[model samples]
Each structure stands twice: as C-alpha cells, then as structure tokens.
Target chain A: MNSMVEMQNVIHRYSKNTIIDKVNLSIQSGEIFGLLGPSGAGKTTLVKLIAGILKPTEGTISLKGTALRHLAQMKNYGFMAQSDALYQELTAWENLDFFASIYNLSRKRRKERIRDVLEMVDLSSFKDQPVETFSGGMKRRLSLAAALVHEPELIILDEPTVGIDPVLRRSIWEELYELKEKGVTIIVTTHVMDEAEKCDRLALIKSGKVIALDTPQKLKEKVNVTSMEEVFLHYGGETK
Target chain B: MNTFHVMKRILIQFKRDKRSVALMVVAPLLVLSLMWMVLDHDDSKLELGAVDVPETMLEQLSSDTLDIETLSSSKAEGKLEEGTLDAVLYFENKEMSLLLEGSNPNAAGAIQKELQSLREDQQNMVDVEYYHGSEDLGLFDYVGPVLIGFFVFFFVFIVGGVSFLRERTQGTLERLLATPIRRSEIVFGYLAGFGLFTIVQSLIIALFSIYILEVFMDGNFLYVLIVTILLALAALSLGTLVSAFAKNEFQMIQFIPIIIVPQVFFSGLFPTEGLGTWVQIIGDIMPLTHGAEAMRGIMLRDASFADIQWEIYILLGFTALFTTLNIFALKKHRRL
Candidate 1:
C-alpha cells in the first residue's frame, strides 16, 4: 500500500498562538486513520491542512507523492466538517446534486452517484425532503452522503458522529469500513474512545502534538492497558 | 460549468423562498404607490382677506387657488390672527402691507408665491415653457425615478447581503471553498442568479411606475429597465463584498444606516448641486447616485442610450470593482 498523505514538520499559527506544532505523520492508503484528541488539540486544523483548505505557516504537506498546489488536486479528497454544511432550503437530492456538480461530474453520473450515496447513507427515501425538516442525525447522514457523492479517493471526516446515537453511529462506522474495503483512504478525527478503537491506526494528539501513533491493539499492549482511554491517558501523561 | 451549478442552486433556493420574492418585487410597488398618493395632489386654495384694495388688483389676485374676502383693516387682522385667513392684504399711503399667518411654512410659501407672481404679472406676463417636464408634473414625478433606483438598490442589498452572510454562518461557504471550484466562479454565479431576478424586478417596477402609477415617463421603457438592472447588479456585488465584514444578519442590518441610508440622500432625492463640491464628490462615489441620474435621464429627460452611457459605464465599473473585491474576500475562507 502507498501513503495517501504525508505531513513533514508542519507548523500552523494564528497570529501569535500556534495551532499545529511540528506535526509529522503518514496516512496509508485504504486505511481508516484516526486522529484522537480532546477538543482544541489542532485535530481540525491538521485535517484542514491535509485537505488543502488551509496553508501551514511552516513545513509542507504532500498528497499522492506530489505537493498540494493546484485546485485540480482538491478533487482527490472529500471533507465533512464538524458542522453539517448542507443547504437547509434545498432538498437532500438537490444538495447532493450540487456537491457532485461542483466536482464536475456529468448529469447522468451525478444522478447515479446521488442515488448510490443516498442509499449508502440510508437516506434514499428522504432525498426529496428539505434538509430544514431533517433531524440532526439525518442531516449528518446527508452531509456524509454529500462528501461521498463524487467518489473521492480520500475522505476526511471531522467528528462525524458527535451528535449521532449509538445505533446510527454503528451504521456510519460500518459504512466507513465498507468504503475502506473499496480502497478509499479515510481520515477521521474523534475524541470518543470506542470510535478511536474502530480505526485501523490511531494517532494520539495533545496540545498540538502527536504523543503516540499505532494500531489500537498495539497502542494498548505497549502501554500495558486494557482500555483505549488508559492508553490515551498514559500517552498524554507521558507527554506532560 | 461550476458557476452554472452554483447559479442553479441559488435559483432553487430562491424558488423555495416565496416571501423574499414578494418582498423584492411587490414591496417596491406598494411603497411607490403610497409615495404617489402623498405627493400628487391638486393645489389647495388659500383664504385671503383684502382691506381697502382696488377692485382691479383684487380681481387679479382672485383668479385661482385663492379665496378673497373684502373686510375692514381691523377685521382682516382679526381673521389673520384667528387663522381663518392665510394672509391679509391692504394698502396704506400708496404702499402695500401684508400680514400672514406664518405657522405653516407650506401655506406661507404658497401665499408668498401668489403675491410674488402677482407683482410679476403686474410688471409683464411671461409665458413659461418646459424644456423637460411640464408644469403639471408633481413632486412624485420628479423623485419617482430616484425612488425606483433606491428601491432596487436597497432591496437587493439587504436580500443579497443577508443571503450571502447566511452561507458563512451556516458553513456552506466553507464547504463551497473546499471544492475545486474557483472563487471567481462563486462570485459570478451569484451575479448571474441575482442578475436574472433583478431583470424581472426592474421590468415589473418600471412598468408599474410608468403605466400604472403614471409617474412622468417620457423615454423608452427598455432604457429604464437597463439602468435599474445595472443598479441592482451593483448593489448585489457591493452587498456580498460588505457581507464579508459582517458576522451575522443583525450586523448586516446595522449596515443599512451606514451603507443604504446615506445613498438615499445622494440618490437625487434631494438636489446635490447646491451642496459643496466635496459633498457632490461623495455622491459621485455612491452607485445609486449614478443609477438615479441615469434613471432620471431616461425617464424624465427622454435621454437616449448614448446620453446615459457615461452613467452606464460608471455603474458597470462599480459592479466589476465590487465583484473583484468579493472574489478576493473569499480568500479569507480559502487561499485558493
């Protein structure tokens, strides 16, 4: 497998305060890579950098062995922000169609992909309903469908399951696993311990720095802990 | 192609928002009709008391728009004081003395104009000819073009600005930037979407004002539409560019006093020529000033397209400048 994204000594600052500090990581293709940290740990910033929505103050980020520069390179990834960035006045089908068209998909392909993504998110029946009438979970599902409508190679989800219930969260995780099986690289940011456990690999981040990185089993065994929370606490305390 | 998609989504959003459509199209006509009602009326006759005035002079003053009554000097003074008479006229020692009830400036000004015209008529009766509008034109006719331009600019500013601001607050703007779409595409897309609606809006307003309300239209109706559409486009671009600085809907409303009201003062609602050069220069920089000017030129002065082409260029310039600034403003969300 090849590395989908690589960050080298990446440092980001907003005025005098550093948001991302000397971060280095490699995300493998066809893997569910998770960035686990408490809030304000620069997880969102790091993903935004990798998504090329932001420019790092120092250091470089490369995707698919090439530097992220041209806008055409943005076609490789799909981003689902913490906020469900769906147009409330538009129907679910219209929203998906819009996102797909911005990716320059043909009319027929956009219709087909909109159907597929809606089906994948189990929102096929709600396609014609306005998003304003959707529940929080349904809006989240539609947001995920928008991100996947174009069949992007890399999918970056920032706290995708925050307001979702356990049953729906399980289904979303299952969908993520299904996408990974199709060789789609997935980068997920989460603060939930169990959600972190579902990732193929985990990077424990604290105070703008990654403290530990490995699979969930290896991270637990190396820290001599049974729970992912203890492994996070051990790594976090060690960093302190 | 990406721009077309953005434009399509906006049209879809607009289709769902019927109230906004009504506000943009119908509100202007309602306000204009109200204005016409308030400004267009036949002149009221003033009540005048005459004492010891010659019969020939009294006949001259008694032509129209005045009610003359013969009374003693004391009785005339009493009538003027009691407010029953707008003015009291008498001659003493071959000189005329006038006593006026001065509480209402409009009434006082009307009496004064009657007296001044009487003096002028005594000297030599001059026939007045209009170069543009006739003497029958009311205040509504004079200001109607400016008000039309104002309504278009004002509604487009609020609606377009608030809608674009919603994108930022709702996070759809960030989502849009994350796509491979160019920033110029977003700006142009908004222009095209809102531009189409403004064309319809301009047509409806121009027709209603010219034919329905009957506010002194002389030039071709198409020129009025063209000027209004350009003005709305200028407002749309400026509103979106200004929205970049606003954080929410309330803040967008706060811009009304700063951005929208001042333009009304400069939009030829009042005469800017008597104002200082610097003040006129300030009016010159505002988009509505040129819009109102071009609108008045077309509707009142019967100006041809070539006659108002300078204003047309200035309005186009404003739209282009604000649109480019808006494209730059999107850089705050995504550097690309």
Candidate 2:
C-alpha cells in the first residue's frame, strides 16, 4: 500500500515546553490507523499536526509525497475534534451545510452530501433541530456527520467515540470499516484498548513517544499476551 | 465564496438569537429617550426678588428666564433664607446688594448668569446670532450625535467580541481552521456578517433620534448613516481582534472598562480640549473619537462629505488595522 502520510522528525513545542517530541510514522492508504494513548499523551496534538491544523516547531510533515505547506492540502482530510464543535444555535442541517460550503462544494452537491452524512449518522429526523437541543450522543453524531459531509479521502477523528453508548460506538465503528473498504484512509485516536484492536494497524503512544507500531494481533502475539491491555503493558515496560 | 458561507452561518446564528438583535437596536433608543427627557427640557426660570428697583431696570430684568417679584428688603431676605427665591436684588442709595440662596450651585449659577446677561445687555445691547445651532438647541441636541456614535460603537463591540469569543471557546473556530478556508476569509466573513446588522442598527438608531426624538439634525441623513456604519465596522473589527486575547466571555467583558469606557470619555460626550496633549492624542487614536467628531460635524454643522472626510478616513483606517490584526490573531489557533 502507498503511504498516505509520512512524518519525519516532527517536534512541536508550545513556548518553552515541547508537547510532541521527535516522532516518525508512515501511515498506509486504505487502512484504519489507530493512535492509542491515554489522555494528554499528545494524541490530539499528533492528529492536529497530521491534519495541518498546526505547524511543527521543528522538522517536517508531508502528505501524498508533497510538503504540507499549502492551505489546499487541508482538502484531503476531514477532522472531528474531541469537542463536538457544532454550532449550538444552528440546526443540524445548517451545521453540516456550513462545513460543506467551507470545503467549497457546490450548492447542489452540498445538499446531497449533507443528506447522505446525516442519514449515515442516523440523524435524519433531527436535521432541523438546533444542536443546543441535542443530547451528548446526538451532538457527537452530528459532529461526525459534519466531518463526513465533504467526503474527504482521509478522515482524522480525535476520540470519535469517547462518551458514546456501546450500540452507537459499534455503529460508528461499522461506518469506519465501510469507509476503509472504499479505499479511504482513517486515522483514529483512542485510549480504549478494545477500540485499538479494531484498527488495521496500531501505534501505541505513551508520554509523547511511540512505544510500539504494528497490527494489534501481531503486537499481542509478539508480547505473548491474549489481551491488548497486556500487550500495551509489555510494550510500555520495555521502553522503561 | 467561503466568506459568504461564514457570513450566512453568522446571519443564521443571529436569527436564532433574538435577544441580541433587540439589545443592539432597542437598548440604545431607550437610553437615548431617557437622556432626551432629562437634558432636552426647557430652561428653568429663576425666581428673582427685586427690592426698590427702578421701572427701567425692572423692565430690563423682566425676561422669560426669570420670575421677578417686587418685595420689601426684609421680606426678600426672608424669602432668600427660605429658599423660596433664587436671589434678591436690593437696590438702595443707587447701589445694589444681592442676597442669594447659595445652597444649590446650579440654581445659584442660573441666577448669576441671568444677572450677568442683564448687565451685558445694558453695556452693549449686542444681538445674539447662532452661526450653526440655534439658541433653542438643547443639551440633548448638542450631545445627541456623540451618543449615537457611542451606542453603535459600544453595542457592536460587545456583541461582536462575545460572539467571536464563543467561536473560540466552543471549538467551532478550530473546526473552521481545519477546513480549506483561508484565514482572511474568516475575518472578512465576520466583517460582512456583523456589518449587515450594524448597518440596520445604525439606520434604526439614527432615524429614531432624528425623527422620533427630534434631536437637532442639520446635515444630510445619508452622511449620518455613513459615519455610524464606519464606526460600527471599526468596533466590530476591534472587538474580534480583542477577542483573540480573551479566554472567555467574562474576560471579553473585562475589556469594556479598558476599551469601551475610555472611548466614551474621549468620544466628545465631554470636551477633550482642556485635557493634556497626551490625553487628546489618546482620544485621536480611539475610533469613537473620530466617529463622534464626524457625527457631530454632520448632524450639527451641516458638514459636507469633504468636511468630515478626515474623520471618515481615520475610522476606515482603524477598521482596516483591526481587521488585519484579527487575521494575524487567528494564527495562534492555526498557522496557515
């Protein structure tokens, strides 16, 4: 598979403190790549770096063999922030319509895409309701719909299912799998070990460093552990 | 094209928020009406007691602003002490001794002004002619234009600043940055979006003051609209730029004392002439100062566009400067 994203010695600093130390990764196309780490483990920062929302203080990042210097590079991916990020005062359709328009989709295409995403998220009935009236899970789903409205080739989700119920989480995962099958690159950041196992390849991050990078099954077999949590502990122990 | 979308989103959000629309258009009219009731009243006539005054002098003192009463010296002194008379003029041996109720300074000053004008009338008999405003022009008329600029600046600053701050705090700004939209597009979107409402707001407030409240307007209505719209644009851009430094809505409000109140002090509500040069220089930099100057020139002096063009340019400059700064400020969120 071709590498969809390649990071070389990416170091990000905020003022005097470094948040993302030198890290390197090559994410393959048509795969669900999971970034598994505990909270504040620089997972969000890493995804943001890849998404081109932030510039690294040192080193380089490139997407599709081109340097991530152009603003047009943002068109390649859809980002769902950890926060729902939906406009509370606007209805679900308005929110998705806004996101779609910003990506410069034509009015006709925007209408069609917005409907498709809303239906995919099972929020078709709630399309006219303002997001302020939505429950936590509903808002989350709407946020996902907003990200998908533009039909980007690469999807970057920062903890897409943090507070979601099991049934909804399963449905979202099923959606991710469908996107993967359609040759889309999905980058997901989650601390949940069970969720990490769902990705085609996993990068176990701890304290801003990648402890291990491999398929979940391979990492488990290498560590001689049946549970992904034990595999994480084994990898985490070796780094210490 | 992206800017149009952002503008549309803001208009939709504003439609959903009805209270903010009311606050922008109605609150200013309410405050202005209260000011008109207080400051636009006819001048109060002073109660003057004249004792042993000649008929000629009595007739001279007998003007509309004074209620002259002939009385004995003792009775006049008693009236003055009781605060029933503002002052008593005691004319004896061809000299005058004045007894005054000195407790309230405003009343005392009015009495003194009546006497001073009477003395001037005797010396020169000068006919007073107003070059711009009439003698009938009330305090509300003198300050009305400045208040119009002030209300527009204040409300636009608050609503625009708080809304932009909400975008940041709510994380929508971050989501917006992740899109392919340019940073300048976002800033321009806010300008155009908030700008439409400011245009409507300025029109309503200016028309209400000129037609309903009947504050003395001497210039073209279009000029007044132009000045107010530019001032509101300045406020909108400055508010968004200031929002970048603020962490929350409360912090955005904290800027009022630091940003809005000082502008009011310098906005020609009170004269800044006697103030130190540095103070006037600070006033010169404030957008409201330029706005108020242009507004006053247009509404009171019947100034042509060329007359207030310097103020117009300064106001436009402030808007441009603030807008550029706002574009730069978004770099803190996402560098493009």
Candidate 3:
C-alpha cells in the first residue's frame, strides 16, 4: 500500500537542543495513525512536520508522493492544532467560510461543505453565534468543522480531545472513524493512552524519539499487558 | 485569492469586535476634540509682577493680556517661584529685563514673545507678514496635521500589532500557515484589510481636523488623505513585523516608547531644525517623520504633490521593507 506520509530520518532542532531526533515514520493511507507521548515529547513537532508547517533540519518528509517543502502540498492537509485556533470574534459559520475560502473552494461548494461540516460536528444550531460565546467543547467542534471545511484528503489533529468530556470525545472519535472509512488518512497526537488504543497503528514517542510502533493489540500483546497504560510504561521505562 | 480570504476574515472579525473598531475610529476623534478645546484658547490670561518699573512704563504695558502687580524684586521672585506670577518685568537703570518661569514652556514662550513685541513697539518696526501661517494661527492648527497622522499611526500600530500577536498566542497563525496560502499573502492580506478600515479612519480624522475643529488646511484635501493612508500602511506593516518579535500583547505595548514616541518628537510637532545632527538623522529614519513633514507641507505650506513626493516614496519604501521583513519573519514558523 502507498504510504500517505513518509518521513525519512527526520531531525528538527530548536537552537542547540533537538526537538525531534532522527526518526522514521510511514503512515498508511485511509488509516488512523496515532503519535502517543507525554507533553513536550515532540508529538506536535512531528505532526507539524507531516502537515508541512515546519521543515526538518536533517531529513525529508514526503506527502502523497510529493515533497513537503512547498505551500502547494499543504492543500491536502487539514490541520487542527492543540488550541481551537478559531477567530473568537467571528461566528462559527464565518470561521468555517474563512477557511473554506482559504482552501479556494467554489462559492456553492463552500456553502455545501460548510453546512456539511457543521452538521457533522453537531454545531449547526450555533453556527450564527460568535465563537467567543462558545463553551470549550463547542469551540473544539467549530475548529474541527473548520478543518473539515475543505474536505481535505489528510487530517492532522494535535491533542484534539484534551479538555473534552467523554461523550463529545467519543463522538469526535466516531467522526474520525467515519472520515477514515471514507478513505481519508488521519494523524492524531495525544498523551491519552485510551485514545492511542483507538488508532489502527501507533508510534509511542518519548523525549523526541519513537520507542515503539505497532497496533494496539500487538503492542499490548508483545508486552503481555492488558491496558495501553502498561504498554506505554513498558516501552517508556525500557527506553529510559 | 487566499489573500482576499484573509482580508475578509479580518473584516469579519472587526465587525464582531466593536470595542476595537471604536478604539480605532472614535478614540482619536475624542482626543482631538479635547486638544482643540484646550489648545485653541484665545483669552490666555497672564499674571505679571512689575519690579521697579516707572509708573508711566507700567501704565503703558498694562493691558488685558497682562495682569500687572507692583512688588519688590524679592517679592516678585518669591511670587514667580510660587507659581502665582508668570513673569517679572524689571526696569533697572535704562535697560529692561524680564524674568520668566522656565518650567512651563508655553507660559515662557508667550511671555518672551510678548516681551519681544513690546520691544518691537518701542522701535516701531512694521509687522512682518507670515508666508505660511497667519499671526492668528493657534497651536492646534500648527500641530493638527502631525497629530492627525500620529493618532492614526498610533492606534493602527497598537491594534494591528496586538491582533497579529494574538494570532500567534492563540495558535491561529500556525493554523493559517498550515494552509496552502503563502507567507507573503498573509502580509498582503493584513495590509489590504487593515488598510481599508484605516482609510475610513483617516478620512474621518482629516475631515474632522480640517472641518470640525477648523484646523488650517491650505492645500488639497485629496493629498491629506493620501498621506494619512500611506502613514497608516507604514504603521500597519511595521506593527505586523514587530509582532513577530513580541511574545505577547504586553511586549507589543512596550514597543510604543521605543518605536512610536520618538517618531512624535521628531515628526515636526515641535521644531527639530536646531536638533543635533544624529538626532535629526534618527528622525529622518522614522516613517512618521516623513509622514508628518508631508502632512505639514500639504496642509500648512499648501505644497503640491511634487513637494511631498519624496516623503511619499520613503513612506512606501518603509512599508515595503517592513512587509518583506515580515515575510522573512514567518520563515521562523514555517520555512516554506
């Protein structure tokens, strides 16, 4: 199967310290790939690399067989950053329409896509309300709607469910699954182990390197552990 | 096209954020109105102490402009020190001398000017005609052109810088970069978007300064609009460029003293003709210096486009340079 993303020995540094060490990753198409790590373990940096927002200092990243060094390649990337990143003063629809226009969707298509994404995120009722009045979960949903506005082939979500309640988190995961079923590749970074288990493939990263990469069952079975927390502790302890 | 999208996003945000919009448009007008009331005072009464002046000369000098009080030199000095008197006019022997409270520059200047005119009356020299301004020109008329440009530039710089800084702090800038839009497009979008609102702001301020406050406008109104708009663009580009270095909104405010205040001092609100060579050079580099000069030339000197063309090009060049730096600055966030 062709990989949706290919990072060959990527190394990214900030000043003297390396934030992402020499690492290799291949994420398959139409699969939910997870980068699991603690905060500051370089998960956001890795996703940003794949999303074409940052350049690797010592290696290359290719997205859908094209080099990820130009802005043109980012058209396929729908990035939802850790923060909501929505314009709080604008209405939810305005934020979605802004991103839709940024992606250069046609006027008619933009309206359709915006409506669809708002409905998908269950935020259509509050579409006209300013985002500053939104609760945390509502803002997150709006941000996800904005990411989905362009109907991108690849979605990169960084810690998407940090402050969300369990019910909303489950619904978001269901939406992610729906997108995956539609042949759209997804990359998610999270510190939560349960969320990591929901991904088809996982890269357990620590301190700038991926210590383990496998399916949830394989990773748990290799360590003979019943829970993802144990699997993470098993690999994270060994690396230390 | 993506640039236009960014512009639209900014305008939409402005629509919802009424406080910021009011700050940009109404704040300057309010301040200018207050300044007009204060600086355009015509009945400025002065308190004077007559020190050993002859009774006849004291009668000659006593007018509505001067409220004369006869006192000893020591008493006169004490009253002057205590702020009850603006000046002490002493006539010892045949020569005339004046002692002015030097702390208040305006009071001192008015007294010195009045003293000189009294001396000029003694010689009876014909009153010199003003080429650019009338003898009736008030301080507001003199500083109104610069104040207009300064306020527009000031409000736009703070608002624009804080707005861009918030984008980074809120992570929207990174999200924007993750799109297919180029970095230069982002800068251009801000210029065009903020440029539109600032155009309205400039029009309101220019019309109010000239028509409402009745500031002297000797040249074409179109040129005043052109100069204020260019000044706003310079401020906009500089604001965004500086925002890259600021980690938060507070740090952005800290730039005002270093970046904005110095420009005011040299922007011809006061005379910089006798300033130090290097100080004048510092003024020369400030975008507002050129802006204020051009504004003064147009509104006060009735200068044509050719006279202020150099300033126009310099302001445009500053905008371009700051914008190019902004594009390069974004490379720190995304190399591509």
Best by DockQ: 3
Q: For all the candidates, what are their Cα RMSDs to the real structure?
A: 2.2, 2.5, 2.4
Interface RMSD per candidate (angstroms): 0.6, 0.7, 0.9
Clashing pairs in 1: none
Question: Which of the CAPRI classes, incorrect, acceptable, medium or high, describes model 3?
Answer: high
- Local error of candidate 2 at A42, Å? 0.4
lDDT of 1 by residue, B185-269 (tens): 9999999999999999999998898889999998988889999999999999999999999999999999999999999999888
DockQ of each: 0.79, 0.81, 0.84
Candidate 3, A8-125: lDDT as tens digits: 9999998999999988999999999999998999999899888878788899889888887667788887999999998888889888888888888899999999999999999989
Q: Candidate 3: where is the Cα deviation over 4 Å?
A: B49-59, B69-83, B87-123
TM-score-superior candidate, 1 or 3: 1
Off by over 4 Å in 1: A237-240, B49-60, B68-85, B90-95
- I-RMSD for candidate 1: 0.6
Q: lDDT tens string, model 2, A96-159?
A: 9999988889889999999999999999999999999999999999998888888989999999
- CA shift at B271, candidate 1, in angstroms? 1.6
TM-score of model number 3, chain B: 0.90
